[model samples]
Target: MDCVVTGGNVKVLAKAVHSLSRIGDELYVEPQEDGLALRSVNSSRSAYACFLFAPLFFSRYTIPSGHAFRCKMAIKSVQAVFRSLASLEKTVEKCHIELEEQKNRLTFTLHCKHGLLKTHNLSFQDSESLQAVFDKDSCANVFRLLVDAVVHFPPSQEEVTVSVSEERMWVRNHVEEEDQSKAMLTELCLASDEFDHFSVQTHNNVTFCLKELRGLLMFAESTGLPISMYFDEPGSPLVLSVTDSVLEGNFVLATLSDDTIFRSLVRTQTPPPPPDDFMNDDIDSYLIAMDTSIAPGPSASGPPTPPLADSLCQKQPAAANHRTRSYIDEKEDDLASSERPPNKKFCSLFFGSVLPPSSQMNTQLVTSQEVLASDSEDD
Candidate 1:
């Protein structure tokens, strides 16, 4: 595959590439018979950008139809080739790209106006294309604005809120730190015609990264086309695009959620532990000792429920062992009472974690007969 970009179109391409470079250091080039696509995503995967240039956008586009291939190169390598886009616009006659399959490299050939030619061989990596499909038709909010109006919008340093309602449409960007909620902001009360169309099926005021939106705005400002915005909800991404006769740029940014909402998600995912300092090893040992309890019959109080320390509440370590011993002794006394009904018998005080509520204890533990024999002389 081979292609060439020349004339003022190179500046537009440069602007798009520059904008995408801010999103990521790596760039993926996809060539097709129709056009070329440059795509990038930021480190945090929060921002994504794609620029597509139609065949007509370039002077000499040559891609064999049905041929398919993709390559990855550092954005810096490509940016270095057009670092002086302003001067290249005047001094460079054209730019050509050809794949050197044998060497596994992309050869960038610059044709200068004064018989000067510079060649750069940029390395590449095997990569796949990134495709994200969203339901634009079902979007809750959509709008279009004159591209140049971007310069007047927030520079992205502050919070940007896009609010739409039946009565009015306005974009407000705070120019201060987040803590300064009332700080001065740039507000544009746009009319219906101010944009190609300002329509919101459902009233919405979505807040998102102004920086990302501003980046796309600056990239497309030179195109002098309209900006198309699509968004569904607060947590979903906000989509922005600019298209002209030559190239189309699409950028998407993940929306920032309120701290409270974010915290709620975290809490839901990981439930807070109970205040009680329960240990599996302690419960295991207690379960192992239960079968050895000496019992006459049922207690008037019935089976003892675990004390707070053994229940859901946490106990201070210094008092833990002492408190647990006392609770156990009381349970043992109740089990040894003669008033206990012959049919009513329990081995130990237990909570949900210690053991199941079966009438008989686990046979694995030493039975009450052995326990009574060992302590007969002392009793």
Candidate 2:
């Protein structure tokens, strides 16, 4: 497999890689007769992303006659190669990708200006094509949102709830069951006019990860396109997509089944029941007097324990907590910190282990020789 990407399209490809890296650890590269498919699924498999770059998107495209070439490699292996998008766009003239069957390696050769070339060879393993099966046509709710819609969300926010109605749409940070009291609820409401196209057959709420949505939005924002959302019930998967004439991206994310988020929102909206008229007006004074009168002596079982608040306020010595590391060590620590714990459940079951032959997909013939790149790489 071999393909070449030239001009500003190189940045677009780099942006695609960076966006996919945000969703999963591994990148699946499939060089089909029609186009090149790049896909990724997160650690928990709760989120899956696919980007198909048509032959027209590349300067030249090529593939072997009847052989099927598909492989999976660590996303970081490829992401690092495009880490510097600015330099790639400014200095690189053409990006050539090829598969070396003899060495079983995928090479990314950057043909930079002044006859300079930077090549990256990544190892990969043969794998089946990763795909999820979902019918967007069945989705009762469909809406288009601008990429800037996420600006209202806090950077550290994880999940978000999307509530849609006939008249309006609401996007808010998800409130978990455990942290409702301490969690800050940030919500953004959009009228029908705000969306490019808003249609809601079902007035429902769906909750999904904000991180994955933001990742996809980054790509959409780069392409100067709006994101379209298709979803059904709460537990069902939510599909977000961005498409152009030559390239398309689809992200399938798992939605929370429970109504905890909705309940939290309701609780926040309604005021407490008038402080309960049953409580005597003197209750506050009584509690204050009891606090001063509590002078219990140590019992035979054990000495009196500290109050809960006092115990929680205690802190360890600063010297014991102080620490330092070298730059390399710090980088390793950062990478390790980013690792997520695996979830027992995933949306892959919805798509199954292998793609169904009847799954909805689009394919187009290559118009350029540099368009088709048969390659997969790993660290």
Candidate 3:
């Protein structure tokens, strides 16, 4: 496969390469009958980007007839070819890309003024085309905005939240609960009328990484195109695209769902243990022992429930052996009682009335047994 880019299109290709570098370290090159496809997926596989440059976009384009293949090269190698976009635009007159299957290399030839010709032969491996599956036309919400609106966001910010309502929209940096005391919060609010085009079939919020968005915006701004976003619910992929007659770009980004945010919040809200003191590991066992002495037995209609103490008491970890010895001794006294009925003693020993009622104790026992069963399954 071979193609030639000349004049202003050289800079356009450079900007496209620069934009793709931000999403992934590897660049996928595919030559098709229609155009050349350049794609990348981030390390986490959560973000994807693709740029298609039609034949019209390039001055000269050629591909072997009935011959199709895909290859991938390090993004850094491609970036090095287009490094220093300022100087590239000034000196480079034309750029040529060709694949040498025999040598297993992708060649880049630069034609510059003053009769200078420079070439780079970079090694690449055969690969399958990287395609992201996302339905853009079926999206319920669509927002069109100028790149300048988000250019002011801090470069250090990792992720941002987009919240839209009937009246307004908010774009803000996402800060963890632990960092709220010290982290800076930056937010941009725009009324519905302020957007270039706003069509909201459903009010929704989504959180996604800002780095790739910023990179794509840079390319859009250079091409004088507005960024269009299409999305449905939070967990669904967010599709951002820039399309024109000759060039088209698409970005699919994973968004954090409301359920994910809620789970994170729940984790952060859990109280921490005391820093100076270590809680006793056998405290629950002791509490159950104390409660069992006074707790009533199961209903007369039902058979006596087996005690959880048999397993709990049999295998005492070494760490808790010292602390639990006294409690075990007390339980032994109840078990040794000869005058009490066997059922009465069994009920008194396992389901004491110290803290919770018999019904509550049964529930606690069932929950503990479930946890143990789960643990065993994991093992």
lDDT of every predicted structure (CA atoms): 0.56, 0.64, 0.64
Residue 74's lDDT in candidate 3: 95
Give the number of the best model, judged by TM-score.
2
Give the TM-score of each candidate: 0.64, 0.70, 0.68
Stretches of model 3 off by over 4 angstroms after superposition: 260-379
- Report the C-alpha lDDT of model 2 over 106-214, residue by residue, as the tens digit: 9999988899988999998887878765666668998887537788888888777788778788777776544656877777888999888899997676778888888
Highest lDDT: give the candidate number.
Answer: 2
Provide the lowest-lDDT 10-residue window in model 1. Answer: 261-270
lDDT score for candidate 3 against the true structure: 0.64
Indicate whether candidate 1 or candidate 3 has the larger lDDT. Answer: 3
Q: What residue runs in model 2 are displaced by over 4 Å at the alpha carbon? A: 259-349, 353-379
**Residue 373 lDDT (model 3):** 16
Runs off by more than 4 Å, candidate 1:
64-67, 146-158, 174-178, 181-186, 258-379
Which model is ahead, 2 or 3, in terms of lDDT? 2
Q: What TM value does model 3 have?
A: 0.68
lDDT of 1 by residue, 304-341 (tens): 32221121111111212222221122231232232121
lDDT tens readout by residue for model 3, 203-306: 67666778889889989988888889987655456888998898899988766532111100011101222343222234355445634632343233233343
lDDT of 1: 0.56
